[model samples]
Structure formats: structure tokens, C-alpha cells
Target chain A: MIQVKNVTKKYGNFKAVDDISFEVKDGEVVGFLGPNGAGKSTTMNMITGYIDPTQGQIIVNGVDVGKRPRKAKKQIGYMPESVPLYEELTVKEFVRYMAELKLVKHKDLKEETNKLIEEVGLKEVENKLIRNLSRGYKQRVSLAGALIGNPDVIILDEPTVGLDPKQITEIRDLIKKLGKNHTVILSSHILSEVSQICEKVVIINKGKIVAIDTPSNLEEKTKSKNTILVTVEDPNNKMESIKDKLKEADEIKLVKDNKDGTKQYAIVSDTNVDLRKKLFDILPKEQIIIFELKKDESTLEDAFISLIDDSKETLKDNSQTTVEEQEEKNLEKNNKTKESKNKQKEKNKKGSKKEDKK
Target chain B: MWAVLKKELKSYFLSPIGYICIGIFLLIFSIFFYLTAIQSASIDLGNLYYNTAMYGLMLIIPILTMRLFAEERKNGTEQLLLTSPRSVTGIVLGKFFAATTVVLITLIISLMYFAILMYFGTPNLVPTLIMMFGFLLLSMAAISIGMFASSITENQIVAAVITAAVLILPWFLPNINESLAALDLMNYYSKFPAGLLSATEVVGLVSFAVMFILFTVIVLKRRKAVK
Candidate 1:
């Protein structure tokens, strides 16, 4: 078990990780979600005893990382962000060296090395020097290094960043297998991968954790409206009048017109209402043939974006009342304007060709 | 500590640095062997090791120690070593002893000259062994300095140049003031070449090595917070 209590890391005046607290129970797989520069790597470095936290404490298996580093560090197996490995050593040799570094007893060393090498599926390329191997193989070698000595906690930072789709799945499967026996903590920017592998999600933004819960719970919490997407064949444009018939409908937005003489609309209402059942009943009375109708379920990606946006809004609100507030507020406003202007220019360039076709 | 020491020693042999260092030492030994023993017709092997220690070590010590920590820092492999369960003291000693072992190997190979002298004439074995011991002490001191220089920088060339300058500059400093002779590594090594055992010199060289090794450990430990 890992308990991180009020941990904060600061590099000079800038706080990389503000005061944050969380815990990972034994045999649990927790996913750390954040955008870039959100202190994910810093927190992992502190937990692995690679760096000291500026404040608070990290206790792993009853050993405090700062107070008793040697005992605490022995329990952690960390694969740093870029998969640093000894390039001169062969895969098997590197794993053996890591096992030795972790203070594995002489008798159990060989068996432990072999077991970890096989578990990471590095048997074939075990003899090859790490410099000659591909990125995927190098990643496995690093993972094998982290898995040696059978540590209780395994921390992997951005493990799948540069992998291909097939390699990503293989690594994710390996992580899932590891989660069965060891407490696993992995950080990633990929939302779908997190939702698939993580039993709990911790969302961080701007160096502060915004939410921590199950993946489904996070999705449910961020979802504010009951909405349904409906595609219909409306020749005379009777869709706008249908909103008046169903009093439960708060807004109806025409999403897109399909090429097959049909149009799609988004119906939004109160969270307690089931808009799909009401839409299925009311469409036929207006002589509008229903092509397709489905409830719009919020995904993990939506939850991530909404949480980040909410954090930004709260930050803006807080900064508005402080000294030099006008300057800080103008800087953010200008940055947003420049970003949206660039996006508008890109959209205009793409739509120009479509305009010619029209 | 043994694990790191073993791997470092293996790495020295696996690369050409070990062979080159030993080979150069042997070449220098032969030159001194011809000049001091054969030309003078003296059975004193002490002068042979002394001359080589004075002229040959300045160049070879840097080559052996320059890449010890600099290369690791440059390639980011320092992360692997520092994150391990091994303490900083063990890691520093491991690399220190590994580099010292390369010098020991060279000294062992130089015994071929002693073997040749034994075949032709009976030489004083005790003084020759004393000279070898003194040479080991001097090399350990020089290697520790070089290792400390290596730890402070990531560029191998800078580390090499700094080590060379540190070893060579003290020789000229005695010209300005006689007190600076204590800084010359060769001054401490001079007595053993003349069949004299100086307890003070042995203590000086050993303490010099210990001081630098401790400094290296402290620097590395402090880097964790500052880095």
C-alpha cells in the first residue's frame, strides 16, 4: 500500500505539484490522468525516492520515503518517463544487473531474473544489446528491469507514449497482468486506455488534482444533461415545430444533414428525463420518419475535457480579485483569442475548397 | 557494491580502454627499464617504476577515469545507478576500485620486466615490491582526483582536460615556492624509488584518496535535491 499525504514539490518559486493527497491500496491499479507538465512525473519521482518532496510525506508499505529511504525504495519498482536503460548491456544482462541493484539474494537472483524476463516476453531478444533493439523492445527491457526483485509497488510513467497500436495493446495487457499481483500506478494522457485499464482514475490539471473516483463515476459526475441523438427523414422541415409538442425538450439542435435525405438532431433535457423514449413517440405524430435514435452517453474523454475546463474557469475566477489581476486576466484572454484565431484560420482554409465545390 | 564493481571492471575489459591503458603502461615500462637498468647496468628495479610513475601516469590516469561518471551522466545512465538501493558511498567506491584495478593490472603485467631481470641477475626484491606499493598508492590518489573531476561534469573532454591539468600543474607550482612540493604527486613517490619506505608518504596518499572519494559521494548525494 502507498499513502501520499499532502505531497507538494516545488522547483524554485514555481510549484510543480501543489499540496495533493491520495492513496493506492495493495493490489489496486490506479491511473494518474493529467495534461502535460501537471506534476505526474514529479509525484512519481518522489514516490520512488528518486527526488524528495518539498512538503508532506509518501509512505510505502509502512516505510516513509523521506525518513527511511533505503527501506522504502526497496519496495518500489519505477520505470521513468523515457525508459532509461544501460545501452551497452544486453537485455538479460541489464535485468540481472537491476536485480542485483535491488538487493536480491544471491540464491534467488537467477530464478527471479528468468521469471521477470519471461513475464515481459523478452526471451527472444534477451541476448541482444539494448542499443540494437527497437523502441518497443527497449520498453520491455525497462519494464523487465522494474519488475525484478518482485517489488510491491510498480510505477510506470507514460509507458505507452511512443509505441505503435499493436505494441500499446501488448504493453497494456502486460500491465493488466501485473496489476493482479502488484500495486500498479501508471500515468498517461490517453483517456481511452486509462478507462480500459484503471479501476480508479485521478484527474489532475495545472498541478492540482481535480477529481479522483472510479472511471464510471467520473463520467457520471461530469454528465449534466440527458441527451439523445436522433436522425430523421424530414422533407418539409417539421423538426423545429416538434419541440413545442414535447414540453420536456429544453433545446433541439440540428447537428448535421446526411446525404441520404435525412438529418440528425440533438435533443437536450433535464437529467431525470429519458429523451429517447419521448423522441421515439413524438416523431411519428409529426409525420417525421425516425431513422435512428440513441442516448448520448458521456465518455471518459468528455469527462477529462470538462474537468480541465472547469479547473481553468475556477482559476480565472480566483485570479480576477487579486493584485495585478487585470494584467493576468488580459494575458489569459489574449492567449485564448490568439489560439481561437489560429483555429479559425485553419478552418477557413479547409472550408474554402468545399465552398468552391458548392 | 560488489555488483557495481564487477560490472565496471567487466566494462573496462569489454572496451578497448583497458587494453590501451595496460599496453601504454607496458611500453613506458620498457623504455624506463632500458634506460635505468640496462644502460646503468644496475639491478635496481626501483628507478624503473619511479620513472614510469612520474612520466607515464599523467597521461594514463585521465584516460582511465575521465569517462567514469561523465559518460554515465551524459547518457542518462546515472539515473539507473542513483535510483538503485545501493548507497552513494558504495557506488563511488565501486567505480573508484574498478579504475584502480586497471592500474593494478598494468602493474602486474610490468612484472615481466622483473622476471627478465631475475633470469639475468639477482635483483633486490624487497625494494622493488615497495616501489610497486608506492606506485599503487600514487595511482589511487590520482584516480580519485580524476573520478571527482568526472563527477562534476557531463562532458568527457572537459573532465579529461581538468584531470590532466590538475595532475600536471602541481609539478610546475613548486618552482614558484618550495612549499608547493607537497602538492606534487611525484614528490611523495620519490622515496620508494630509492629503496626507502616513508610512512608519511603512504599516509598522505591514502588520505588524499579518501578525501576525494568522500567529496564525490557528497556531490552526488546533494545533486538529488538540487537537480
Candidate 2:
């Protein structure tokens, strides 16, 4: 189990992570989702004890990280943003070295290292030097390094970033298998991947966490309007009048024209209404043959973007109000400077145009 | 600490650096042995060790120590070392002793020179042992400074250059000022050539090695937070 409480990382005046807190229970697979520069990596770094948080505490299995780093760090297996490996060492040698560094018992070191090599599917290349391996193989070598000590908490930062589709699936399956016995925390900007592999998702934006819930719940919460796409053979041009006849339909907009003498329209209604069924029943009564009807399901991608954009707007508003009250004069001066620069560029373009005309 | 020491020492042999350092030291030792003892027609092996320590050590020390921390940091493998369960002191001491062991291996091979001297004439065994001890102490001090230089930078060339400068500068310092002779490592090593184990020189060399080792540990520990 890991508990991160009110952790914040400050780089001078810039805050990389702002007072974020979360908990990962043992045997849980949690995905950290955010856009780039959203503090997912920073939060993971603090949890893994890679860097000290400017404020707050991280406790791993009841041990405070700041008070007893060695003990706390012993429970974490971190694969950093870029998989860093010792290129000089062969695959087998590197894994054994990592086991030794993690203080595995001398008696079990060989057995444990070989087991990790087999587990990560690197047994074939175990004797090869890491510098001679491909990128995917290098990533697996790093994963093998992380898994050698069998630490309870395994933290991976953007683990599948540069992998191909097949390799991504392989690594995802590996993480899922590891999740059976280990508490796993992975961060990525790929929304669909998170929704597929993670049991819970933590959404962050602009150094602050905006939401934390299951992927389905987040997708459900942000879906305020019900939308359905319907394709119909409206030979009598009765599609425009369907909204007026069906009181449940709020609005209907033409989406596309099909080549088979049919038109597709997107119908919007209240969240509680099932417009698909209503459209199927009423459109047939009007002698309109329905070709297709389906409800639009909001994906995790929409939830992520909406949440991040909402938080960014709120931050911009807050900063704007503060600037108006405290630094109006300086703000005005900066705006004037920008305007003059734009005017100078405009004058240069006009001069060039006049020279061409002459 | 044992884990890191084992791997670092293995790496020395796996790469050409280890063989190069040992081979160079042996070559210098053999040349000095002939000039100082065989040509001089003396039974003294201590003078051979003293000249080898003065000339050959400066080059060998940098080669052994240049990549200790500098290469690790450059390749981002320091993250693995720092994040591990091992303490900073263990890691520092591991690399320190590993570099020292390279010099130890060269010293053992220099024994063949001693065997040759014994074949020609009776040599004082105690003084030869004392010279080996003093040589090890001097090498330790130089290796520690070189390792400390490696920890402060990521560029191996810069680390090697800084280490060479540190080892060579104190030799010339005594030439500029008479009082600066106290800073000279060779000055501390002077009595060992005469077969006298000076207590002050032994203490000075050991303390110097320990001070730099501690500095390296502190720099690595502090980098965890700053990095």
C-alpha cells in the first residue's frame, strides 16, 4: 500500500505538482492519465522517492519515505520516463546487479535474476549486451530490472510510449499479469490504453488533480447530453418535421448524405431520454425506412480533454482576476509593447508590397 | 557494497581499461627495476618501487578512476544506483575499493621483479614489503581524488583531465614554494624509498584518501535531491 498526502513539488516559482494526494491499495492497477506536463511524472517520481516533495509525505506500507528512505524505497520498483540501463553490462549481468543493489539474499540472487529474465521474456537475449539490443528489447530489459527484487509497488512512467502495436499489447498483458500480485501505478497520455488496462484512473491537469474514479464513471459523469445518429430513407423530405412530431427529440441536424438515397442525422435530447427507441417507433409510422440507429457513447478521451480544458479555463480566470487587481500597469505596458511589434511587422510587409508594385 | 564492488571489478577486466592500466604499470615497473637496481648494481628493490610510484601512478590512477561515476551519470545509470536500497556510503566505498584493487593487482605482479633481484643478491625482505605498503597508500590517495573528480561531472574527458591536473599540480607546487612541499604527495613518499615507514606520511595519505571518499559520498547523496 502507498499513501501520498498533499505532495507538492516546486521549482523556484513554478509548481510542478501542487498538493496532490492519492492512495494505491495492494494488488490494485491504477492508471495516471493527463496531457503532457500535467505532473503525472512528477507525482510518480515523488511516490517512488526519486525526488523529495517540497511539501507533504509519502508513506509506503506504513513507512514514511522521508524518515526512512531506504526502507520505504525498498518496496518500490521504478521504471523511469526514459528506460535507463547500463549499456556496458549484458542482460543477465544487469539484472543480477539490480538484484544485488536491491539487497536480495545472496543465496537466492541467481534464481531470482533468472526468473525475472524468463518472466519478462528476455531469456533468449539474456547473454547479449544491452547496448546491442533494439529499443523494445531495451525496454524489456528495464522491466526485468524493475521486477528482479519483487518490490510490492511497481511504478512505470509512460512504459508503452514508443512501442509498436504488438509490443504495446505484450507489455500491457505483462503489466496486467504483474498486477495480480503487485500494486501497479502507470502513467500515460494514451487514454484508450488507460481505459483498457487500468482498473481506476486519476486525471490531472496543470499540476492539479481534477478527478479520480473508474474509467466508466468518468466517462458517464461528463456526458450531460444524449445523442443518437440515425440514417433514414426520407424520400418525402419529412426528416426536418420529425423533431416537431416527436416531443422527445430536442434538435435534429443533418450529419451526412448517403449514396443510397438516404440521409444521416444526429438527434439530441435530454440525458434521460432514449431517442433511439423513440425514433425507431415514430419514423416507421411516418413511412420512413430506418437504415441505422445508434447512440453516441462518450469515451475516456472526451472525459480527459473536457476535464483538462475546464481546469485550465478556471486557472486562467483566476490568474486574470489577480493580474487585473495587482499588476494592471505592467500588464498594460506589456500589451502596448506587443501591439507596437505587430505594427512594425505590418509596416515592413507594406513597404515590401509597395516596392513590388513600383 | 559487495554487490557493486563485484560488478565494478568485473567491468574493469571486461573492458580494456583494466588490462591497459595493469599492463602499463608492469611495463614501467620492469624498466625502473633494471635502471634502479640491476644497472646500479644494488640489491635494493625499494628504489625501483619508489620511482614507479612517482612516474607510473599518475597515468594509471586516472585511467582506473575516470569512468567510475562520470560514465554512470552520463549514461543515466546513476538513477539505478541511487534509487536502489543500498546507501550512498556503500556505493562510494564499493567503487573506491574496486579502483584500489586494480592497483593491488599491479603491485602483486611487480613481485616478479623482486624475485629477480633475490636471484642475484640477498635483498632485505622487510624494507621491500614496507615500500609496497607505502606505494599502496600513495596510490589510494591518488585514486580517491580521481574518483571524487569523476563524481562531479558527466563528461569522462573532463573528469580525466581534472584528475590528471590534481595529481600533477602538487608535484610542481613544491618547486614554486619551499613551504608548499608539505602539499607534495611525493614528499610523503620520500622516506619509503629508504625503507623507513614514516608514521606521519602513512597517516597523511590514509586521511587524504578518506577525506575524498567522504566528499564523493556527500556529492552523490546531495545530487539525489538536487537532480
Candidate 3:
């Protein structure tokens, strides 16, 4: 349960997070998706009360982070972007200290510390100092620190960065498990990770929120046309002419040519139109062998890129479409024409004076 | 506050800084022990603690306090500490007491000199204890200054230098202006060596320590905004 209302963070004249507002329901796993330096970490820090927001308010479980930071912070377990940890401390000692900082009861501290150490799979290395641990283990230690007191909300900034694939999967699985009971907010540039693990995705770009939706909804919203990829062996070179038979197909473009003489074509149609049946009936009659046919389903990666690009386009358009900007362009053009005309008149007058002197 | 205090205390011993501070204090105190008490054949332990607090603390205080906040900020561990539910006052006080405890441990070991003095000659126990208490206060005041220096910067070297400058400069202030002698911590220790429990010196040293401790806390609290 988190509510960020019109929160903005400004550094000098630059706004790191610009009027961005989003909420996470209880027990929801929300993914903060953005490119590097897209204000994701800044937003996470504001939510955790690690840094004060330049403007607006962040409420954690009904407590304002700015007003009652301690009470609000008590409900949050934050693993910062850098995975800040006490390198000199042993794994168990670090977890125990975190438990104590979270004010865990002395009676339950040891048991809770051990449970978290095992949960993050650092039991064998529990006694080992954190400085000697590998990066993955260090990350797990940081996570254990966050999870020490079993806080209701867990905020991890780029949880799986720099980890190997296996370690990434392990961490992702751990986060997914965390999502079952706790409200989790994780920021990452990896779209597939967000799509696979998060229930809702908030895409931010250039200090602004581009879009916020479920993973599937974002993917589906970005797909404007139904696109199908068809690979076929066209002995008679009838692939281009097949578009005549499938009238529902809006455009047929060659995508690639295979070494086996089969050509791949992408057939795009208007929404609610199915070109597969018509192509299936027409291709064989036209002396083309159908090899592969499947719809081109867009992934969250495509959705993210399109959303970011669309926001960039809108920003550009906003600057270009203003009436004052149009008027300024017209004035510039008029000034250039007037300057040329004056130059021509001056040249004519100089020529006439030379003629008169001769 | 207790949680932060315990962890900070544990961290002091876990790192080499704790052992190094203690070892260096003892080494200097022993050297002073010989020169001040043993060689002079005097039972006054005041000069022993006096020299230790003067020369030994110049090095020990920086070593103990330079890493208090500088190392945490440098290593990014400040994020973990600041994000927790603990207040800046609690964190600063926890570290303050931890460094003070290390000096306390060294002071306890320095009592062996008092034991030896008791064996060979009669030493005034009241004056010795009074000086030791005054020495603790002086060290606490110096530690608070060092901790304040550490909180303002992320560079340990810079923090150490600032702390050393803060402690070393006040000694030279009285040389420049006789009236500025009150600013000197050693100036406040004048009466304690003679077993006179002057309330002015006690309150003065404590208030000085409190002033710097509060400064450190304010520095940390304000960092939350700019950081």
C-alpha cells in the first residue's frame, strides 16, 4: 500500500522525477520500468524516505513519509540501488543488526535472523564476513537485511543487476515469492523481468511517466495492427501477387529470404481481420508452399520501446505545434525575404550610380 | 537507539580501527607513564592522563571517529542506516558512545599505572580518578568534534584532517589571544589534576561535547534533503 501524489524531485534546475504519481495496492508487485537514470531510483528513494522529495507527498500505508518518516519508514524495507551493506559484518551479524534497527524483539531476533538468512540462501555463509562474499551473495545479504523484520512493503532498486542468469532467476523467484504476502516495488530496465514478475508496470522516461498498465495490457495497447509472419517456398514468385487474393491484408512486405529458396513475408491487416484462412487457401493454389505461419505477438520490450518513443514524439510535437512557435517561424521567414529584397535594391542603386558617373 | 548502539560498538571491535586505537593509546600512555610518573618518582597520575589526552588522543580520536560516518557514506552503507527507522540523533549518539567506549577501555588499562603507583608509593586516588574522569570528558569532546567532521564529508582522509585541525587549532588560539585560553580543552583540565572537582570544568567540558554532538546530528539530519 503506497501512494505517491504529484511527487517531484529537483536538483538545481533539473527535475529528476517530474510530477509523477502512482500507487501500489496491498500485496501488489509493481515494477518501475525505465531506462538508466530515468528517475526510477530517485522515485524509490523518495518512497522509502531515504531522501526528501522536492515537492508533493508520499504516503506509505496511510502515513505521510515527509511528516511521520519514522512511522512510515517502519513499514518499508528498502534495498537501495547499490546494495549498500556493511562489508566488515558477517552475514548473520548484518541481518541481526538490521532486525534490531527495525526494532525486532530480542526474544525473536535470533530466530527471525536465522530464518531470513536461510530464506536468502546464505546459511552456509552466515558466519562468513560479507566482504568475502561474491556479488550475488552480497546482493542476497542486502535483501536479507531488507527482509529482516518482515516489513509489509519491500522496495528493491534494480534487484538483479550484474548477476548471472541463474542468479537473476533465483533473485526473481525470491521476489515473486515476496510478492505473495508483501507489497513489492522493484525498479529495473529489464522489461522481461518486469513482465514475468510484476503485476503492474510503470514506464517512466525523461522524468515523466509514459504509461502505467498491466504487462499484457501495455503490450496489447501498443499493437495497432494484426501482423502475421508467413514463410513460404514461392517457385512461381507468387508471394507478391498473393496480396491480390487476400483483400483483408492491408500490406504485404518481404521480411527475409531463406537459403532454401523460401521467402518470409510479413502480412499486416486491419484490426479484427484474419488473413490466415484466406492466405492458407490462396497460397497453395498459387503454386507456393506454405512453410510457417504464426501471428507476431508483441512482447513487453516492444511495448516499452514504443511507449518511450511515442512519448518522445509527443514531446517533439508539442514543441513544434505551438501557435507562437509557428508565428515565430513565419516572422523569421519574412525577415529573411525582406533582408534579401533590401540587398537587391542596394545593388541596383549602386549600379545606377556607377552608370551615371560614367 | 540501543540497537544502533550495540551494532556500532560491535563494529568498532570487528574492524582494525578499534584494536589500533586501543593499542596506540596504551603505547603512548606507557611511554608517558614512564616519563611522567616512573622517571620523576612522582605518584601523581595526572600528568600521565594529561599527556595521553594531549598527544595520544590527537591520533586516536581521528582513527576512532573518521570512519564513523565517512566510511558509511563512502561505502554507501549510509543508505541502509538512514533508511531505517532510527533517528539521526540515535545514530550519532550510538557512534559517539562507541568511540567513547574504546577510549574507556584504554583508560581502564591505563589504571595499571595507578596499581604500580600504589605498590611503590602513595598516590592520591581521588586526584587520579578525578583526572581520569576529566580525561574521559576531554576525549568525549574531541570525539564529538571528530564525528562532526566525519559527518560533513565522505572522504575519510578529509574527515581525519578536518578533525585533527579542529583539535589542534584550539591549542594555538590561546597563543594568539590570551583571553581565548577558555577555548582550549586542556585549559579546562587545570583543576582536575589537583583533585579539585570544579563544577565549571565538568560542565564546560560536557557542554562542549554536547555542542559538537548536536552539530553532528544536525549535519546528518540535513543530509537527508540534499543527499
Question: Considering every candidate listed, which one attains the maximal TM-score?
Answer: 3
**Stretches of candidate 1 exceeding 4 Å from the true structure:** A316-358, B39-42
Q: Assess every candidate by TM-score.
A: 0.90, 0.89, 0.92
Instruction: List each candidate's DockQ score.
Output: 0.43, 0.51, 0.58
**Candidates ranked, most accurate by lDDT first:** 3, 1, 2
Could you tell me the fnat of model 3?
A: 0.84
Consecutive 10-residue window with the lowest summed lDDT within model 1 chain A: A317-326
| TM value for model 1 | 0.90
Alpha-carbon runs more than 4 Å astray in model 3:
A316-358
Clashing pairs in 3: none
Cα RMSD (angstroms) for every candidate in the order listed: 12.7, 9.0, 9.4
Give candidate 2 regions above 4 Å deviation: A233-241, A246-251, A258-263, A285-287, A318-358
DockQ, candidate 3, vs. native dimer: 0.58
Q: What is the TM-score of chain A alone in each candidate?
A: 0.88, 0.89, 0.88
lDDT of 2 by residue, B15-107 (tens): 999999999999999899889988999989878998898899888898889999999888878878877889889999999999999999988
Rank by DockQ (best first)? 3, 2, 1
Ranking by TM-score: 3, 1, 2
lDDT by residue for model 3 over B114-145, one digit each (tens)?
99988998888888888889999999999999
**Residue B13 in model 3: lDDT:** 86
